[model samples]
Target: MKLTILGCYSATPRILTNPTSQVLEMRGNMFLIDCGEGTQVQLRKHKIKFSRIKHIFISHLHGDHFFGLVGLVSTFRLLGREADLHIYGPKGIKEIITLQMKLADSWTNYNLIFHELTSNDSELIYEDDKVEVYTIPLEHRVYTNGFLFKEKEGNRKLDINAVEEANIDVAYYRKLTQGFDVVNENGETIKNEDVTKDAVKPKSYAFCSDTMYKEDIVPLIENVDVLYHESTFLETQSHLAPKTKHSTAKEAASIAKKANAGTLLLGHYSTRYKDVNCFKEEAKEVFQAVELTQDGKVFEF
Candidate 1:
């Protein structure tokens, strides 16, 4: 799995920084995490094909998180895209997009599907053979949710030497890989464990933004391979975190430590601080595997 940060700054876009937007590439799927303003431009700058993004997940109705959605949809129409686009977000997202289209007298040529979420509970939103996406209910000024992307367990590997010794037919190899015992032509029972090896463990990634330092999320994101959490303030300004429903760098790191995440990626930084290195420095005091996100940085796992 790979994640490309299209934008990472908080609140607004500037000449060198952008708001919250990211592209997660996994299991042959490209998922747009947020549509903050200037997301399309950042996508283009990073050479990520807009057409490859089939699903979009919006954390909340906050403009910094979803203001560029309408423009992106319109761009797809202008590009003559025929493929369907799926958007999962907070409730009323469909109404918001439809209203924009109605006001502009412009509708998308492609199919636009919306999965509006109103429940505060963590629920599975998307699932396929390779991956699953779940909503991570969050505490914010407005209704918000983070997303957890987890890879499914893969098929077991067949032990060719053991299969040959057991005289297992090629036709039964598929069953062996599936961890199923098979009966041979000789009426012998071939055990799956004797001819198969365990598959590699799957990895998971979590995305949390525009939320406060809520420890309840630790269980949901426990042991994630990578965690992208918003750190909108420095430790010195921690007093503002709860008031603004955002987390400071140290608070985000604490959550990461509690969750036992492999890597803690801090982003959605406040623009007041010109040096983003300070955020990383503050987070490292609590979590060793801390990394600061830039507008176009990529992380592969």
Candidate 2:
């Protein structure tokens, strides 16, 4: 799994920074996490094909989180994209997009599917053969949710030498890879473990942004391989975190520690501070495996 941060700044765009937007590449899927303003430009700058992004997950209706969605949809139409686009976001997201299209008298040529979420409980919103995406209900000024991406267990690998030594036919290799015992022509039961090794360990990524310091989310994101949490403030300015419904760098690190995440990625920084190194320094005090995110930075796991 890999994550490319197209934008990471909070609230508004700056000369050198952008708002919330990222592209998560995993299991042959490119998921756009947010559509903050200038997202398309950032995608272009990063040389990511717009059509490759089939699904977009919006955390909330906040302008900094989803302001560029309509423009991206329209761009797809102009590019003559035929593939369907799926968007998962808070309730009323469809209405908001449709209204924009209606006002502009321009509709997308490609299919636009919206999965609006309203339930407060964490729920599975998307799934495929290789991956699953779940909503992480968040506490923010509005109805918001982060996303949890988990890779499914792949098929076990077959030990060709072992299979051949056991006189196993190629036809039964498929069954063996599926972890099934097979009956040979000699009526002998060949155990799956005898022919195949274990499958690769699955990896998971949790995205938590535009939310306050909510400890309840720790259980949902426990043991995640990579966690991206928003740290809109520093501990010195922690007083503003709860008031603004955001989290401090220390708070984000605390969540990472509580969840036992393998690595913590901090982003969505407030523009008030010019130096982002402090965020990483403070977070590392609590969670050693913490990294600060920058626009256009890429992380692979």
Candidate 3:
């Protein structure tokens, strides 16, 4: 799996960084996490094909999280895209989008499916053969959710020595990879365990944005391979974090520490600070594996 950070700045924009958008590429599919303003331009800059992104997940109603959605949809139409687009967002998003379409008198020629989220509890929102997406209920100013993407376990490994010794037919290799035992023409039962090793453990990534420090998420994102959490402030400005329903670098690090994530990606930095070194320094004090999220940076797991 590959994750490209399109934007990373917090409430305001900066000369270098954009807003809060990310693209996750998995199994030849691109899944967009957020669509802040200028997302399409960033996608172009990264050489990402917009048509490959059929699924989009909006974290909340915050403008910084989804303000670029309508523009992107319109751009897709202008580009003559005919594939269906699936969007998962908070309730009322469908109304807001269709209202704009009605006012402009421009409707999409392709299918647009909206999955409005009204439930406060976490739920499985999307799934396919290779990947699965789950909602992570979050604490924030507005109703919000984080998303967890997990890659499914791979097929079992073939034990060449055991297969040759057992005289397993090549025609049954596919079934063996599926963990099935087969009988040979000689009337011998070939055990799956003898011919196949264990499957590789799958990797998982989690995205958490625009939320206050909430520990309940530890269980939901426990031991994730890669975790991206919003860190809008440094330890010196921790008082401003909870008041604005945002998180400081230290707070984000604490969550990562408790969740035992393999790597912690810190993003959504406030523009008030001229430098971002403070965020990295503070977070590293708590979680040694923390790293800053830079626009256009690709993380592979």
Backbone clash count for every predicted candidate, in the order shown: 0, 0, 0
User: Largest lDDT belongs to which candidate?
Assistant: 2
TM-score of each: 0.94, 0.97, 0.95
What are the Cα lDDT values of the candidates?
0.93, 0.95, 0.92
Off by over 4 Å in 3: 159-166
Whole-model lDDT, model 1: 0.93
- Tell me which of candidates 1 and 2 scores higher on lDDT: 2
lDDT of 3: 0.92
Put down candidate 3 lDDT per residue, 63-153, tens digits, no spaces: 8889889999999989999999999999989998999999999999999999999888889999999889999999999999999999888
With a 3 Å backbone cut-off (N, CA, C), the pairs that clash in candidate 2 are none
Best by TM-score: 2
- The 10-residue segment with the lowest total lDDT in model 3: 9-18
The alpha-carbon deviation from the true structure for residue 33 of candidate 1, after best TM-score superposition, in angstroms, is 0.2
Q: After superposing candidate 1, which stretches have Cα over 4 Å from the reference?
A: 160-167, 183-188
